[model samples]
Target: MNPCRPEEPPTVGVEEEYFLVHPGSRAVVPASARVVARASAALGEDVAGEFTEFQVEGRTQPCSGARELRAELCRVRTALADAARAEGLRLCASGTPVIADADADVSGDRSGDSTLTYISDHPRYRAGVLQYRSMLDDFAVCAFHAHVHLPDRETAVLTCNHLRPWLPLLVAMSANSPYHRGRDTGYAGWRAVIRSRFPCLGPPPYAASLAEHERLATAMAATEAMLDPGMPFWDVRPNPHLPTLEVRAMDVLPDVADTVALTLLIRALVATAASRAAAGDPGPRTGAELLRAAYWRAARDGWPGHGADPLTGRVLPYAVQAQKLVGHVRPALRAYGDEDEVTAFLDRLASRGPGAERQRARMAAEGRLSAVVDGLVRETCPDR
Candidate 1:
């Protein structure tokens, strides 16, 4: 297949995960089964269960542009929120749960042990819980994934290389998890911190070819680092079953506008990268260690904080790097007719700060984590 042309931009799809929380206490509630059933009746297959019962995922069909994507996002989110309300729970789009019943003994047999009770009954999730143990205890974190169509597996692998240098910026831009387990974790995106505990965490390794990527994935599976080659858990990767590059570096955003903005930016980034690769650009050969450091810093400080440029080893404010990313992908954005919308979103981010900063401000004003959760719930499905 030929690479995606500038005039014919690739279709994009998005998957967003959300939390079900108590209305007054804001504690995560394990009600996904009921909620998903109710929501699926309205949204059909777009609504599904996640690893834990406290979480639910909504997927959008492939969309040609930001406007269509935004409509789908709003529809699914509104449906899920209404379903949660029907189940006497509120929907939250934050990356981490603000509060949880950490000590509740859900299993009648296991006294004082609520470890595996929250996990969904799916075999895959059960296996993950048994293998990872305590790692799944507080694993209610949610993320936003954008799938950008590519010509083929080879092109998608190459595009992953092109996307490495910018992954940290995406992380910082979507930082939403400021508090976890009922208290501030002192990090911008605590969800990133929790995810770092996984064996295949951070940006994926650079692979010169599809064969090399397969070799690495096979080795990781052999080591039991992940369940299989299909589950690398990297920030970005070529989808194992789809003809698209899936970016999983971002947190689930509260606002649909932010979600649409990020999705447009990701589509532009993929288009620009694939175009460069078609023109014989091998993409930046950033070292894995440098990229790891950059990701950690981005997760720690978020935007307006110092961020390291993995390509140059130069540390700059995240806002500077964000502008540079916009400049880098300006041509593609313009080609997709997303320049104005994306620029306006960035301006709004600059003025009001990303979700993490806004969350922290709300915490300060209300002096309560529940208030922050309230704000997130309000922002999550404002249309409903």
Candidate 2:
């Protein structure tokens, strides 16, 4: 457990992406709102709806670090699972679920939206509809979002600033969107590209300070490009409603354990960045160029690609980048006293096998797209 000190920082929240499957068919089901209505008693006034019908999200009670975050996720996943099961439904956690049929529309049903029958109504959703209507015509996507609390707006801004270059690293580390529409999309995180369909919802520009962040947000809002601060779909972004940094790039992790590992890694990143900034170190030398390289790298090869050097644009296979990033963030990992957690969880991910690689291999052997998706269903949620 991460011992929470009074000065150890304030609040942290997590958002989860879940899908309902049609029982024996194991295909997508439009049962989110139905399950949500069923779980409201258990959710007990604590939850938020994601952009799609298939996605039901929950925000955790704020916390200081990873230990608390894990507990929160377990609680929410359990509740959701129980509620969904009661309705003869099962929940799936993957970037994209395997489909036997294409009738499932992931992008919000505009008709559903027009009637205000959707789950949540943040301005972000409204602007997203206006900006990406073309791409979203009949598409539906699902993902998990993790929002970590910072002590102040400045820390949030600084976290966003320093963490930019490594956004791709985070994305790569969590890539699980290997298969889509019954086919391997070739991209490690097709979901990233899928979600990028929204207008004001891509990566944020390089901002030096809180003032600059405000300026960027103003420009986006004024142009009516994005709905508001809720947009900006950077792999790592600042959350306007709360004093936290939200990571929007990861796919839904396979299991509670893997989700715990990913959560620990993210918390370590934010804590290290925040602590360094508070002490005046300003974090690492990551810049837009290097960051863009990381983004493209993950969008392309996921965990296998080598990280690119910010200075020379040279790629240092993960073998090389691992040394630098681990060395660079070691102090914070040590400071957070999460070295054991990081090592334990990361080793499992490294050895347990990467999802995308497994997906591609499965497709080669199975020679069937449905088989690939079925393999994924087995991978993400196994019936014990």
Report every candidate's CA lDDT: 0.86, 0.64
| TM-score of each model, paired residue for residue | 0.96, 0.84
Give the CA lDDT, 0 to 100, for residue 29 in model 1: 87
- TM-score of candidate 1 on Cα atoms, chains taken together: 0.96
Over 4 Å off in model 1, which ranges? 1-4, 104-115
Candidate 1, 1-384: lDDT as tens digits: 245476577899999999999997899888999999999988998999998888999999989988899899988998999999998999999998888766632221334654457678888777776677667667778999999988478878888899999999999999999888788888888888888888877788898878888889889888878777866778889887778899999999998998998889998888888888877788899998888889899999998699899978999988888888899989889988998888888898889999999999998999988889999999999865
- Error of model 1, residue 258, in angstroms: 0.7
- State, as a TM-score between 0 and 1, how close model 2 is to the true structure: 0.84
Off by over 4 Å in 2: 1-12, 63-67, 107-127, 197-199, 281-290, 361-384
Best by TM-score: 1
lDDT of 2 by residue, 1-384 (tens): 121222343345667777667567767666677788877787875554566665676656775666787777777777777777887877666677655356554443456435333324557565565665656553455666777666476656766666666666666667777777666677877776666555555445666677887788778777866565544555667676666788777777766666666665676667767766666655455555555556667767887666665534677665455446667666666766656776776676567655666667777898865555556545544642
Residue pairs in candidate 2 whose N, alpha carbon or C atoms collide under 3 angstroms: 12-63, 106-140, 107-139, 107-140
RMSD for each of the candidates: 2.0, 3.9
